[model samples]
Target chain A: MSIGIIGAGQLGRMMALAGYPLGLRFTFLDKSKDTPGAQVGDIVLGDFMQAEDIRRLAGEVELLTYDVENVPVQALREAAGDTPVHPAPAILEAAQDRLDEKQAFARHGIETAPYRPVDSKEALETAIEALGMPAVLKRRRLGYDGRGQHFIRAAADIETAWEALKGAPLILEGFVDFDREVSLIGVRNRSGETAFYPLSENSHEDGILRLSVAPAGQPALQSEAETQLKALMEDHGYAGILTVEYFEKDGRLIANEMAPRVHNSGHWTIEGAATSQFENHLRGILDLPLGSTRPRGHAAMINCLGRMPALEPVIRFADTHYHDYGKSPRPRRKLGHITVVRDDRASLDAVITELMPLIKAAEGGE
Target chain B: MSIGIIGAGQLGRMMALAGYPLGLRFTFLDKSKDTPGAQVGDIVLGDFMQAEDIRRLAGEVELLTYDVENVPVQALREAAGDTPVHPAPAILEAAQDRLDEKQAFARHGIETAPYRPVDSKEALETAIEALGMPAVLKRRRLGYDGRGQHFIRAAADIETAWEALKGAPLILEGFVDFDREVSLIGVRNRSGETAFYPLSENSHEDGILRLSVAPAGQPALQSEAETQLKALMEDHGYAGILTVEYFEKDGRLIANEMAPRVHNSGHWTIEGAATSQFENHLRGILDLPLGSTRPRGHAAMINCLGRMPALEPVIRFADTHYHDYGKSPRPRRKLGHITVVRDDRASLDAVITELMPLIKAAEGGE
Candidate 1:
């Protein structure tokens, strides 16, 4: 009767909040008692990678899932005997490694930035020569949100980039000349049914997402993204939400990465879509029929980084929805976010213009 | 920093769910630990009348409110030394007693059913003589959803009605010949700013609310309800949401009763209005700016009683939102509710027609 989660972060907290309305119970496996999910549910504090903890959690609940992709995949397989782990753990393995993810995309005929593995200093030198200059050298494992990455510009910069990333299993990649960055959320069920929310135009600064605008409405761009995502879902036999990030270049969508869970980019769907990604994820994993994925209207979500905003006045804005993560504020931390949805594009644009400054002010900017 | 509610029923649970997105915390006081609110927040298990418990809760939270109106008023006043209670304890006193409620309406020149207090069998006899042959006699307090009252249809039925009602103070009233029953939700904050959600036509079965259709949209009918509610809110210096039920007869709005909390009729606003009543109540109680209460086109909410409905299929309905109370189902107990919202009237009506029988089947009706 209870849905068990491997991580009890804010996403799990939101999943619990969304699930409670449909009469679902929740228990979370978290190493710390201080997580957001622990604030609202039953939690077992233990390391997610520990086999004993995963077995203990599975013994308590029959269905298992993870909010974050950092869980140990082998430990998940041990727990997947009597309990089914949605997203299948293999998807997590693929998504967690940069090279494996790119290989999967390549095999599926999906275009990605050209990349070659670099396991040693000699291999790094060979990959740089093969891929050319002004590329990015990244750790293949455990990298997220621009962390564990170094930019290789000219020949002079290769030594510094190597010095920064040579300690880990690395990949050297070509740079993308992208016009804009966008992402699409697709959900599939056990019955092989699928639904896709509209494409969202995303803007990031310093590798942190700053804003997301839904239904970026370029039909051709969205259709192309959908085709690629549908094939990827079927390839993995995935049963839940999958978010694929893309770079729009020459009016074509090139796949960059995919997340095997409900994503921050889809947060606008809570108010903008008829069925939110969180709800659909639960429904999909439970094998329930997927709800409608249609966008209600134009919506924009602005992330509050570093600190809680001066939200007292911000909430007064019409059609604005605000959420605070309840985590202690720290520099560059995702403290909270707000969404503004409207029936018209002009009204939505006006609100976005008015809100971005407030968001910036909250982040200690001019 | 947090809102303290005197009772931890499902309403408090819903209030917490609504408030969490706005960066608010909640603590609840309830007699049972098994209630829905206990599942989500800090709860104190004690009687609402226990002064020590009340003092303990007040010590922790400076802003106090209640979900259910039946809390001990004097205890609430005792708890209000440094804390402020929204809608005030006096409004609760007025709303609790039928005689006082009628008197308040009369003082404001509001039209209500013709009535007189019946303290004894002699008083009942006199009231029947003065009022008419067909009348309803109701107890003064602690009665809801038709729990109290007996109908006196003829002279021969007087003794039995008096015998059934003689145990407590009562009121004899002439029932209105109404065309339809409708309720309006009006919220006012500390700054005297007021906003009203559109009138909702409500249908009740056995005096329990069954359905509410938002924006009944007869301008003349709505203006009258708004005028009377504004007078009542100003009269009491009320802060928070108040739901006033009215009867529309001969195109004239007749006052029936009012509740001093976020009400069942307004639950449709969670996804159908620009602002939900739970959020507006928090805003009003915190002296924050009230959000817009404009209905988004049309909405209908169906209350599920007695048993849990088969909702996996129901959730797939487009634009339909469901909430289960997370309580064990009991006969005649309100287990949960569903709301169907749309941007057009015909679509809403169509869903309502399609859903009503399913709801009735869930309630063991059809």
Candidate 2:
């Protein structure tokens, strides 16, 4: 069976790599044939945002899914026709806007930082006064990797934040003094079979993910997160992978944002877990039996931003795997990643520390 | 960089899959685009035996390698001009014939069954008389999986065995039947670095491999096999995976044959070891540092002959990985394989016992 992927980025490439062993083929829809996905699979040369292109791809495959979250939901709904689109267009619509996403979390009783929609300067003032002095003003749609948002620290900065993000649908959220960030990656099929990988503790620098370590959250926190995700998935009648990024403060998880796709935080599952998230995502979308999500070892995945480290230096370490996305070097791009698995967390941390210098040196050299 | 593979079978398909993560591309030369390797990589549609086709592929890629054993060594040597070929054509030339292979093994101090070249009926009789009653006559070239051979049990069977194999260049050998079979997979790089996976105990039915269990032999046996393989690789200045199959009789290993590429017995290394043989093969030929060959857990790889079992039923077992080569079903043809990894050997055995019936039932249905 062939799967049609709307956006042919590295995620689609990895998915194709994982799905091939299961005897599945992939066709990718993107503007250019020079993408990571296009390198490994058939390409449909067209824009993913265009309804006509999506329909063409949908017509060629048994099912449709996507890599990028910015795809227009209305186009997807209209183009999918009889072909099933996993993670459903309805959920994509909610995930596209911040206010809608928060409301969806509220309906499931999932806690989030207090927020209010702001459409005008007067509304922004009202939201800031009600929430607190420290708040964030963000464009409600198309924000990712810390872009399209500004921080409001004092009364003087409210206008500055507004002036920066004006003329767009916006949201004001109360500032969260988060202890750490973690993400839960879960999958559900049409048959109602659900499975989840252990929560991964993530660290970010300058709005982009820098590192992730798996099996980080407490057992209670993991179960609580799973319960929350399960309710949300059932509500959307979801299939395929769903990821929710959360902030942990005072032993509680505060909802931050969610993505209806395979996540960077779960990349360690490729070698750390019994089954990879990419393979599970395919299985979930096809309504095949869910694979075991048990952890194989303590794993740490570090993202290679802007430039990838030399392959020879990185692979010299034992149990270390390097992934180059077959992409050209660009500043702050999701160029590639390196994963290291160890018998214990201490060893994993030690290796990550030793390897970080080599990775940083490459970034500096570039 | 792109690597050119001569024959696009399951081994080449697997090599391409493993190399993708290392930021490498592949171009395969084969008769049809419907092959397993062609499904995942670019294909140069041509016959592997044709020198002109091999030259065309060599001109397109940086280096070349072969998947099938019968690649006509003279053609490879002539066609691969300036483009390096791993496991050099010299090794291929020796491995193509049984007599040359036995002589090569002896040169490395590797012991093998007593054998003699047989041309006429009188020569066959003399060989059988010297070797005694249970003996075998095998064609010197292009024989595999129990094909092109006949067994001679007594005097009456001598003429029958000679008649069956008389037309081709042949060899008569004493059969070793005391114990189980095992194979050692080893790799060496141009930089003279070498690594070896633990010996795998294998089982065969009708001279075809049915199952392989890794980390099977004693430490002494493993070290001895590794030493023997190291000597052979050093002699050849090999730069890729090389496998040596043995007949273990009364705790001593008798060399049966050797393959100049990755062996089926090493398939368990895909998940059971820290790095798969396929990936290591790429690293070796590229002269990059070889990966760790440490076994992660007890692993058993079962070949799916003629037909593949249902994906859902096979993946339901935790730690089980399914690999379908996307080949059309043919009687006794190797279609795909399933690998199951466990924390211990006993549990691994138990799961294999449970999974066999399901796998066999599919073959029967087909």
Best by lDDT: 2
CAPRI tier for the interface of model 2: high
The ten-residue window of minimal lDDT in model 1 chain A covers A357-366
Candidate 2, backbone clash total: 0
Tell me the DockQ of each model, to 2 decimals: 0.75, 0.87
Candidate 1 reaches a DockQ of: 0.75
Share of native interface contacts present in candidate 2: 0.84
Per-chain TM-score (chain B), model 1: 0.97
lDDT of 2 by residue, B1-366 (tens): 889999999999999999999999999999898999999999999989999999999999999988999999889999999999998999988999999999999998898999989999999989988998698899999999999999999899987888788889999989888599999999999999999999999999898999999989899999899999999999999999999999999999999999999889999999899999999999999999999999988999999999999999999898899999999998889988999999999999999999999998999896
Off by over 4 Å in 1: none
Q: Work out the iRMS of candidate 2.
A: 0.7
Chain A TM-score of prediction number 2: 0.99
The CA lDDT at A26 in model 1 is 82
lDDT of 1 by residue, A216-322 (tens): 94888788888889999999888999999998888888889999999999999988888889989998888888988988789998888888777677877887888
